[model samples]
Target: MGNQQSIKIFLALMLSTAYIFSFSHFGALAYNTLFKNTDAFAAGTAIGHLDISEKTAAEAERLLEEEVEKWKAKTKITFSYKEKKAEADTALYEFYIEETLRTLKQGQKNLAAVDVDQEVLEEMIYRTSISLGTVEIDTKKLAADLLIGATMLDESGYTFHLENYIPEAVRKSETISKATVNAEGSLNEIKALLKKMGTVEIPAKAQFSFLRLVEEKDIQMHHSSALSIMGTAIYQAILPTNFSIIERYISNALPSYAKLGYEAKVDEKKQMDLVFSNLNDSAYSLQLSLKGNKLEAILKGQPFLNKYSIVKKDEQSFTPKTVKQYNARLESGETQVIESGKTGLLVKMVRKIFGESGELMKTEIISEDFYAPVHKVVVHSPVEPVQVTEQAETGAEEGEEEEQETPDSTTDENVPMPVPGAHSESEDGTEVDEEDNEGDEKGTEPQTSDNTGQGTDMPAGEEK
Candidate 1:
């Protein structure tokens, strides 16, 4: 009985062990199949704001396409310039879907768990998705198309014109400031250009360009020099004669009334321009004219400010010093004046604003202008006067010696001999022939007949 009981116990123990082994093997196979066949995300799989988990590649692509299409439809781009406006559809912009998919695939490869640690796996599951990149616009092509449209609009005269809206009843405001500068010399050419410039009506709050107002064709440029003689000193001033006159006239004309205006120097090569803004609310007309020797620029508009005054203070004066230069072209002991000395000026220009009741409102410094001084130059020749005098004396002595060596009469066969009794003394102490004297007095041919009325070959003073 004891032996049978021990055999049963042994058989039960073996069966229990086999059952446990079979169950463990089946559980491991099922777990591996779940990881391989399920469509759920492995770990750390994301793209932008998209939840791509538990989705096939085809499903994710479809969702992303739909989302991008909606975004493109809603997006609108517009460009504006003044009153002109342009619009462009977002569909014209290029978007890269394949490139985005490739990036997402790369992110997926990084999440593979072949040799990943527990910490790494946790990080991958919690990390944010990668970007799908941005849509790109063909800006060069867009600009070309927009430019064509803008050109068409301009040709159609759709652009705004400022001249049609000028306000009437323009009145002269208080003389903000009056600048009286004598035109250095005769500015006839500049006066002609100013006359051609006519009058320009500037719109309210508009800016003005001086170069544009006056074209190169309007002014005739001539080669001229600025010559000034002060006492015994003479100055040959070199400057851009054509542009200098224009610059000086404009410089004197502008910023007279208001201190807030700007000054610009235009350069064609450098692509720079001169511009000034009219800060007043009413339209202003600028008229330039030449009165006598003065260049006058008048600003006409309704008075924006009640009273304005400009104060100019002398800051410093620079006196030119005399400089001596040696000249090889001049004779010795001779001095030529090249330039007359000029004084430089540093002047502070200030604008004073006053209230209607005669109270000063404010004083502002407009500019600190500096005028460069021209130095006095005296040119002296190095050649000595004694050397020139000696040369003249030597030349005179050589001429006298040559004259003494030459004979008064020629002995050559071709030379004609002097006729006897052909010479006669005139009242003026000059030697003259009788025939020539008679011809001169009567203004006719001399007669050949003598007292005997016989034609003879003897000379005029000889009696036949």
Candidate 2:
């Protein structure tokens, strides 16, 4: 019994020692993974506005060097609003791209330090703002955008709208696209509601929903016409931007306040909506203005690399059909024009994108719409009543006979906006599930951001 007890104590002591050793060894391994030796960045990680996920230290260094070289080649950023204009060259300021990559740590976020000449930019901003009758300038925000844009290696443009400087942050950035529609409406009740909506900001890779806006605003049902006109203006504004129109529809009849082939009809009860997604790498602001005889919708953001032109073409008109009617009191074989007919029409809307040097980059058809015409109906008295029998005459006298009616095969065919693999629904037709979550139709993907006020965290390494 004594020997057995001693053996049991020895086994227990060995098990405790093994347990402690194993715990210490694996704990150190876990610590290395979380803090020290893990060699890859977390997914969706960015280093100084540069996405360097899954990149080793060497790889990130190479990427940062390449970006710096590209930026050195194209680092000009222009600014303009209305008549005020200014230009900036980031290369002259020399943002710290090399310093950013030098401190890259294994498995961590690294934000780059961008150096911008704020004093000179402030002078330009002041001049531009004063010219526009504004005195305030947000030099920090402008500098940030400029720095980030510099790292992006593209020559873009921005606006000096004070709205973004205000406490409310109006969210107007660069002026990407704008469109104006000369329209006047009598919906006075909705003017206040519309005015309450000062300015709308669409975030990067976000969508603008018309019906959802109205519903959130708690607009009354009677203001649908005003909403539709507003929606039309928004659609027109988006037409010239890089933004993608997802679900736009036209009414069966054209609207009086909207331009032909440019109408976007929204019906809450019918579940029709006008939705567009901001497809760029930046956020955008949309402003609606109501002047004496003008209703304008302007989409403001960083200047798009290309310009867009909305064109209407290929208009084909069809002759209206004429039908005859028989009247007993009229003279035989006499035909009267009961109703004047109108011609049917179909139009194609195309969007043409042009380069900065005025060269055509691409041309895409937005939609094709066909409007039906009113048929011409005529009344006629025929002289072919000689074949009628006495029974038929008696039945006609007893009001039992019916008159023959004319046949019609005319139809209106409207083709909607085409999407990835198929076409969208026509006028007041079925719904296509194309909201373009990423604007992929235009090779656009949603840009993921950490939203860190600064570009990203600084990387760490042995060199640090």
Candidate 3:
């Protein structure tokens, strides 16, 4: 009897609990129906952190649109790989608003769509990649995360990294720039060096060294002076392109075989070197060939994106002074040029890079050279050393007085006078007739005839 009574008590308590739960649920539903507008968004309807509680569908749509536009205006995505970077801003934002709103109105929750052209976005990023370089990007995740994580309105702009650079293998390419120098040296030795260097392959971003390429035995056999000619040719070839000069030194006296400002002076024992860096990320070749007396240096690789030109400007010249030495062996007023003077030169060479549309991109000074001058030398005897003294002057005057007392009556060739019956060409190309008897005495009167008729042989002073 006691066990049956305990079971009946438990049943009664269960019935009471069910009745209370039902009453509370019905009460809450009636309250919502009476207080809330049926056409409005249910409680806790939100899009992009904007509260849409108790707001009409049209009002919620306007607010969400404004929020989206605001986020887009403030949103910018930076996708980078190594040093290359690409950016996309408001253009990447084309959210699907109606679909999101319909789901939310049907008591379901969904995120707005941040749809974009994956092909176009990927192209934009990959364009910055170099010829022997590549990058990787995830367009799907990049598009969805903007709205899924609700980070669209985040003030700190998004910066996503694409894959690290994957470099491609390099090979020999066409010649981009070249230079040649005619040097006076042994052709066989230079040919040997060129043969050893052959087609030098320079790795991307490698520092170039002229002496490093040649062997120690070769350096000892052939002099640095001859090697400098080759270095100068290589230097000139590099100036017209976008290569960085690392270390270069000039000779105290400019060599006869090297270019003015482009000479790369090298002495193996002295540790002088011609060093430069290939700052670009592409491999190149230095093709050396002998053409007669010229050493040709050609840079073979892909062409630089921009055009490069070497311009020589800002020239200054210093005149050498004349040095004279007196020579007792030379006669007075005699001169001989023992040395020909040369004028000094101060010149600069610059590299100018231009864009495809003819816009100046950059300018760099390659070299500034100063060649010393050798002064002019001459040997001459002064006139004062061989001048007439007082005694010689008095004797010279007495001799002059004696000559004046005995002046001759010879016709002075210096005096201007007409000759008798001088030969002349006739109008018809025949020689005019001349008289035979010739008397050339200075005091004799000139003979003349009356104008009547006998033409004496010829009139003395008339054109025949």
Best candidate, lDDT: 3
| lDDT string, candidate 3, 1-464, tens digits | 99999999999999999989988998888877776566687776666467787788788789888888777777677765433456755565566777767767433344564577666665655554443223334456666654444333444577664432222233326778889888656577788777666787778768888788765335454477677788888888887877777667666555677766777776677666677778765678888898888888899886665788988887667676555444455575676775576676566777898864568978876665565554555545433233456766887888753222332222121112224323322223333222211121111211122321111121124221
- Which predicted model would earn the best TM-score? 3
* Displacement of the residue 346 alpha carbon in candidate 3, Å: 1.4
In candidate 3, residue 334 scores what lDDT?
77
Instruction: Please give the RMSD of candidate 3 to the true structure.
Output: 24.9
Tell how far residue 301 is off in model 1, in angstroms.
1.2
Worst lDDT run of 10 residues, candidate 3, spans 436-445
Could you give candidate 1's per-residue lDDT for residues 102-200 as a string of tens digits? 556523432111121334322222221111012122333434443332311122212212112222332334322223223435465545555666665
Model with the higher TM-score, candidate 2 or 3: 3
Backbone clash count, each prediction separately: 2, 8, 0
Task: Tell me which of candidates 1 and 3 scores higher on TM-score.
Answer: 3
Ranking by lDDT: 3, 2, 1
Across 168-208, the per-residue lDDT of candidate 2 in tens digits comes to 34434666566666556644634665666667778875887
Enumerate residue pairs that collide in model 2: 103-459, 105-460, 110-457, 111-456, 111-457, 111-458, 174-301, 325-380
TM-score of each: 0.34, 0.47, 0.51
